[model samples]
Target: MIKVGIVGGTGYTGVELLRLLANHPSVEVQVITSRSEEGIAVADMFPNLRGHFDLCFTVPDVDRLAECDVVFFATPHGVAMSMAPDLIRRGVRVIDLGADFRIKDVSLWSQWYKLEHTCPDLVEMAVYGLPEVNRQQITDAQLIACPGCYPTATQLGFLPLLEQGLIDHRRLIADCKSGVSGAGRGASVGALLCETSESMKAYAVAGHRHLPEIRQGLSEAAGRPVGLTFVPHLTPMIRGIHSTLYATLKDPKDGLQSLFEERYKDEPFVDVMPEGSHPETRSVKGANTCRISVFRPQNDDTVVVLSVIDNLVKGAAGQAVQNMNIMFGLDEASGLGIVGLMP
Candidate 1:
């Protein structure tokens, strides 16, 4: 069995990892650290994991983490970079669920995160863990940099159009809405029930951190630098992301639906819905699936694509587990065979 260690088990993503791994036949949770919640039973903190894990939160120790086959850093940005280097040298694979090694340029990452990157050299080798695009790289990578939630939904929505060079890459717009859980488990005045419910507003219009990451991925697919306008919003719900993407069709492709279907035909988690069908966020709640649909309203040049995913599932922990499955050569769908939670 693949031994796994999770750093920072108190947060949403950390516990989410344990929740999924609990049923994974090929993996075992060996260590889970939380300096703040040390000595507390993990199940006691997150009752949802009551019967799954008998482990407790402990302080992060490199020796203990290095003993595992792979270490998942579900902590804040800086925490992973500081500790990943040591664990990596000990032959332990490192997968960062934070933005520590996502952006290739150290300076750009520093600018967005407001902290100097402690281990910039590792950035070059950290394979971006987007299974749809970088599955091959992720299979043999020593370090994995999982994509952000907004980026995952937005990129999946725009990838087909950009890949075929059928759209105006220079005039792309992604208006995304995410639930409060994307803000993390921290105590934030903006994330309170009274503060966020019955309210919706777009933030980071000028520039969001995920902007660069999205641009980089699209630019790579388009084979040129892409000009994009990405705007993200905070929705009232607590578990999903809905991305409405717009782009001008430069080539006026004949089979847009077929194109999207063909591209993701072999991908396990990407579901390209039938023509004219709208994918809903709740349809993928608690499931590691990105449901998408394409539209060409008015038979005009402007094409619209809608994408939805559970912000905490396909957008975060679920995707992280998917990457782990690939890294260990197990069934890609193992432990991820989850159904959507509907009301």
Candidate 2:
């Protein structure tokens, strides 16, 4: 079994990783680190893993982690870049579920993340870890950059159009709504139960960090510079992301449904619902599934697409595990072939 280590394992994504990897047959959870919760029993912090993981949180020791077959950084944006370089040099495969290695341009990443990147050299080497688009690169990469929640949902919703040159890349807009858990397990006033329980509002509308990340992915698919107008909203729910994307169709011939179906024909995680079907976020909850449906407005030439994913699963931990499976030549669905739980 491949030994795995997770840095910053007390956070939502980290615990989510622990939940999934604990049962992963081909891999073993060797270590889970948490600076704040060091020396505390992980099960005490999250009772959900009581019997499964009896381990305690520890400090991040690079040497000890390097001994593992693979290491995952589920920390904040700047934390991974500082640690990934050292881990990669020790011949350890690293997958970062943070923004550190996701953006190819260090300058742009720094501008949005508000922190200077300590390792620019690794930026070019880190492969974007969207399995459907960058599968081969991920298989050969030592460092994989798992996508952001917003970007993952948005990119998957629109990639088929961009790949087929069916949309006007210059005029792309993404309006994504995510549950409160997407903000992480922090004690922010904005994320309090009373505050977000029954309200729905948009935050970071003008300059959300995911904007550039989405553009980068779309630009790569389009093979040209693409601009995006993105707005992110916080829904009152607990664990899903729904992205409604709009783009002008260059040619209305293939349209939305046919284009999406053709593009994701071989993808295991993505399920393109039938034409005119609407996918509910709860339908994809607790699983690494991205359900998509497309609609072409009768009068307008704009294509409307809806994409839903479990923010913590396909959006974070599950995707990180998916990258790990790809890097190790295991089936991408090795430990992730779980069906969604629907209410």
Question: Highest TM-score, which number?
Answer: 1
CA lDDT of 308 in candidate 1? 98
Report the Cα lDDT for residue 212, model 2. Answer: 89
Clash-forming residue pairs, model 2: none
Per-residue lDDT over 144-241 for candidate 2, one digit per residue giving the tens place of the 0 to 100 score? 99999999999999888888788899999999999999999988999999999878999998799988899999999999999799999999999999
Clashes of 2: 0
Clashes of each: 0, 0
TM-score on alpha carbons, each prediction? 0.99, 0.98
Candidate 2, residue 38: lDDT: 90
lDDT of 2 at 221: 90
lDDT of 2: 0.91
- Candidate 2 — worst ten consecutive residues by lDDT sum? 250-259
Cα error, candidate 1, residue 317 (Å): 0.7
**Candidate 1 per-residue lDDT over residues 98-141, each given as its tens digit:** 99999998999999999999988899999999999999999999
Model 2 quality (TM-score):
0.98
